[model samples]
Target: MALSFLSHCLIGLCALSLFAWAEKECRYLPGDSGWPSIDDWSGLNDTVQGRLIATIPQASVCNSLPYGNYNSTACAELRASWTEAETYVTRPAEMMNPYYQNQSCDPFVTEKPCELGNYAVYSVNVTGQEDVLAAIRFAKEKNVRLVIKSTGHDYNGKSTGKGALSLWMHSLKTLQIIQAYESDTYSGPAVKIGPGIIAGEAYEALANVGYRIVGGECASVALAGGYTSGGGHSMLNTAYGMAADGALEWEIVTAQGEYLVATPQENADLYWALSGGGGGTYGVVLSMTTKIHPDGFISSGALQFTLAGAPNESSFWEAVRLFFEQMPSLVSDRNSLQLEIENNTFDVFGITLPDQNISAVQPLVAPYLEELTRLNISYTFTTNFSATYLDYFASIMGPLPYGPYPPTEIWNNRLVPRSVVLNSTANNLLIDAFKLAVADGTFLVGCNGINVADNEQRKHPDNAVFPAWRDAIASCSLTAFWDFDAALEVNLAVKETLVSVYTPAIEAATPGSGVYLNEIDPWYEGDWKQEMYGVNYHRLLDIKHKYDPDSLFYGHFAVGSDEFTVDGSGRLCKI
Candidate 1:
């Protein structure tokens, strides 16, 4: 009788496993029985006013195996223009990071057959709020995976998904300036910008009106989308605050297909979450209204130097250490620095000082210059002044390069707290970690001395920006790139070094600190929730559930993404 009972228990366990497998839930994919039929797609296209598009990989134009449109001349032009930011700007499925696309249609891989791989299967050209609503309702009704894209400038593959329906929001370019916008906690001039407005366009438009707003340093980053939602840092961050800090209201379409305005007073939770909680989580944003500051004369500085020889290696690090030490004082003076260290070269692209003159910058750099001279290091330094932020941006920031050709690059970032910079022992550890990190990839650092925690009026307590930013003196990113046609192991090895070696080194030096969500490693093996949102993750998750209970909008590493897993076939399935 006992043997019979044991056999019965084993049989029941096997039956339960089969039942679980049979009950697994996954979003519909092409070729699946549940996938929308051609008629269903045609109906959705009509609903969206014929803006629904069957996605063809942007690089397909260069490949004969994929869509058979290959022409040698066109392929050459496509390869030439591939690295330009504008190449992917208007393309519905193109993304900055091609690793997520599974190299399906890489322009450079002519030996392999080009396939759609992981690019969205379909997309809706979002021209208006109605389009956004139509896409949302269609995806929900059909149980199709949905994703959002604006400018395609995302770093962690948030804008693109495999076998999904994408809402391409690049054409909604509306910009309206409110000269005297009034709100509950503030009253000021604000600009209402469409989700499609890139940083450069917004800067130029605001400058034309004799005003400026905190925006991304990258010219192609969309102002109202993931940039702001990720707590965007800017050259003006030290002077004002983060990009999210300037936001006053958001016009969005919810998962339930309702159009609503989220502000400090109404849909308050949604407003707070959308402000800094990662984008593509809560709702589809249509436009964002943000506070604008009067345009003023801006002063900037640039410096560059290289390791003269092997003998100067120690001195080079010493100079970098000295520069890191001065970060606190620079922040105290409302100055921002963008520095890059790579291949034995150090470049300070710009030190932005708004509403000030070159004279004000001279004093701040005197100590660093003195150290460099003492170390017998040669360097180049220059300073300039501009009448408006746009002029300053044009001269100092310039257009950023778009790619590591087929887009095989990854970044890992950490926020260096003020305490770490102030502590001598900790500072040396941080510098040593920088050395180890730069050995594998480029090390980029942004030092902004703004204390958002102190500026309670500008950054509300409820805002979802990682709390670490409040105490951070600098932000550091270690980026690794590989050849476009490199083997899978090569890419995996690079990711391993970043995740296992560099990330831990930085974290050890700055314990309890968090990373910038916008720039973190997508394959990070750490406590991402704590690292990205800190103590705010719980609240953000709660809000995410409240607004999107079914988790319709999914992005890698976004809030509430843990509930689903991408299966072998690239289908998003509940875990």
Candidate 2:
């Protein structure tokens, strides 16, 4: 009886120890105590299949000892190439967040020395679910903040955290095509992609098998990560739907270290939450299964007219105004339209009539052509009908935006409903706002909506993609940029200009509508709960608490993010 009592007492003590460990907040860096020792981290690295890498700032590649295998000449080339998209995307620590690098060091400034700031001290170069699970378990048990990253393509600063452990999911590149995916909710063709698989790669692979999937416009974007979870928009969206709408299932590692498959019938709540709840807030997803469509032809093209040569600047604005009025009909006809205006240049490009040929597309575009001629604006309009989606992407879509340089920029978005676009006064207000943004050198872009019609044939779970998207006919965004050498105050002024110029205009134009959460202004000050998620914020919050009660995962502007604030020093502090 005495021996048995002693054993029970030891078990109780171990449980108490675990509880206490979970309760205490772990501090590192500036903190004098509570940081994990080298041995503790080494043990964790071992458990994760030896994938942990202490983050080294990319800027250090040139200045570090022995040049890390590069000579002075090679270092110079690397320094110049550091500004390219691949340079940052390939590294675990380097990313799009200017604040992560403290906005002090950049490859643009040849004279200034670079140093790391606010970047995670260590990153797990995750290749599988085991690494993610172990990292989640360690972060929760030690009460250390955790950041999840895949390809470092996140526009918002969600993938970076100060003095934290990061799970770099970029190395987890795996893809498989299921000729026939059978499920109670969905029974069709599907593609299972690891967290690291990019949108372009997925498109190429799917096209090879006579299938195509809805994914992001950017080729470099990670489809299985934030893109799908945040309601991915695509050129194919007009004919199909948002990327999240095609999602059939996800395999994720929860905060409790449980690796579970979430589907419509199993872990239904998690499935719903993750579908479009905004990534980095739910569990770390290992793989995502997305519905694929049969490969088909897409009638796509671009038309550009110089605003400078127009009779007056108002003439260009008039063209844009007329375009907005026709958006609903164009969207209904399965046309994905895009408008980009900067300075004296105006460009319109997109795929129209996904199932129709170029001959059928000519009549649809004839109206816009007539309008341009009547306005005395000579425009260059070129249309091509590709045999497959891959041809369309490679020839038309991929080359549209050009290279991925100019890594830093200020951007914001608004979803304009069809009703508002049809309203004359509201439409003019949006036009005036666009003009103002252009005057401030902000690049303007707009896309016609994809979820114009619901397909009753395809069954899926409900997600948190702003319900405004359902009624909206178009999504518009404004972007302002500066070179790496631009002053901090200049960037701040650009953000303020965007806020002062576009925010109220969008509000006046579409009173009840909201912005796309994924592309929303990082500095957006409105009621995010209502704007980003519409009526779904409350349910998403509940799901967040259910899975991450301690708030281990946090994406910027995500549900339950109000509990924490990023301080001036770039530290994420509990409210």
Give each model a TM-score. Answer: 0.93, 0.90
C-alpha RMSD for every candidate: 3.7, 6.3
After superposition, candidate 2 runs with Cα above 4 Å error = 1-27, 62-75, 109-113, 399-406, 446-461
lDDT of 1 by residue, 1-575 (tens): 99999999999999987765643478877887678899999999999989988987767777777578878887888877776677887688787775675567877777787787778888899999889888888888888889999987777788887778999998989999999999788788999999888888888888888998898767877889998999998888877778887888999988888889999899999999988999889989999999899999988788888887324789998888888877787666557888887758788877888899879887878788888888888899888889998888877556432212233357778889988878888999988888887763344433434445455334443688788888888777776664565765677677787788778988999998988898877778778888898788898999988888888888888998889888888888887
lDDT of 1 at 409: 53
lDDT of 1: 0.81
lDDT of 2: 0.75
lDDT of 1 at 5: 100
Alpha-carbon deviation at 152 in model 1, angstroms: 1.8
**lDDT per residue, candidate 2, 218-301, as tens digits?**
677789989899888877776777888888899998887888898888999998988888988888999999899899898876
